[model samples]
Target: MTFVVVQNSNNDTMTRRELHQAWGTQKEKLKLKFAALTDTDLLYPEGMETEMISKLALKLGKTKEEVYQIIKAI
Candidate 1:
């Protein structure tokens, strides 16, 4: 299986609550993993974390927590 390497200087993964801090990298990873996902689908605006999570959960047919884990894993 091909592995996605998160290339951050710190090599640390951010929590869901901190997704905004690491969103640029996270969104690209999400796009690579799910070609169907578009920029609009992952448009996480400032102060709209819940909305972004809801959108992703709806599109992926997953719970919010699952979505959190998916982001964390990448």
Candidate 2:
């Protein structure tokens, strides 16, 4: 799979569409990485990368930075 990095105003980089697509393809991997995460937890909205990170952080009990790191690594 290919990813196109998009930089937000806060300078955090993410591939919004690609990341969402990755979630679909990598659902099982994500579940393995974060057992507590569910399909609901993986939902991504357009242009809401920060919100997605925040939601993931809350659900996974990680910091926003940590969530972003995980997403980047994926």
Candidate 3:
């Protein structure tokens, strides 16, 4: 099962699908950004930071693996 949460400008929450769609967009962007880096680049801490990846996982209320798979599909 999948779950999602969305907050509107007025702080109203959206449905799971709605939040997932929004996360899908962000995951696509993250995929692009992640793919643009070289393996070496990803290895270096100062350059390709994985912090945002972690943060994104938390922000989207999804697991790291879930976010990772999303990025892969994009």
Candidate 4:
């Protein structure tokens, strides 16, 4: 549960990682959520917008997959 947290002028917070191990815990949670989703859900055309992805990442707690999809769509 060791994470780096930063506060921005806009009153937002985030973690800064210099290594993969720092993200391991969150990554595992995302992996479990991904595995639990049905194929239909996964293929349901997640909106590939950076803003949308960021919003969903904050709301649903997703990780790189959605970000990758958004980049791919771009």
Model with the higher lDDT, candidate 3 or 4 = 3
Error of 4 at 66 (Å): 9.7
Which has the greatest lDDT? 1
Worst 10 residues of 2 by lDDT: 1-10
Listing every candidate in turn, what is its Cα RMSD in Å to the true structure after a full C-alpha superposition? Answer: 9.7, 4.2, 11.3, 11.3
- Per-residue CA lDDT of model 1 for 1-74, tens digit only, reads 22333323345444344666689998999999988899999998676666787799899998877776788788
Please give the range of 10 consecutive residues that has the lowest summed lDDT in model 1.
1-10
| Model 2 ranges off by over 4 Å | 1-12
- lDDT for each residue of candidate 3 in 38-71, tens digit (9 for 90 to 100): 3332222322224544665666677756655555
Error of 4 at 21 (Å): 5.1
lDDT of 4: 0.41
Clashes of each: 0, 0, 0, 0
At residue 58, candidate 4 shows an lDDT of 55
- lDDT by residue (1-74, candidate 2, tens digit) is 44667664557675767767676666666778888888887776656667877888888888887777776666
Q: How would you encode candidate 4's per-residue C-alpha lDDT over 1-74 as one tens digit per residue? A: 45654333444444333223333443444446556533332322222233444544555565646544332323
Per-model TM values vs. the true structure:
0.72, 0.67, 0.36, 0.28
State the displacement of the C-alpha of residue 40, model 4, in Å, after optimal TM-score superposition.
20
TM-score of 3: 0.36
Higher-ranked by lDDT: 1 or 3? 1
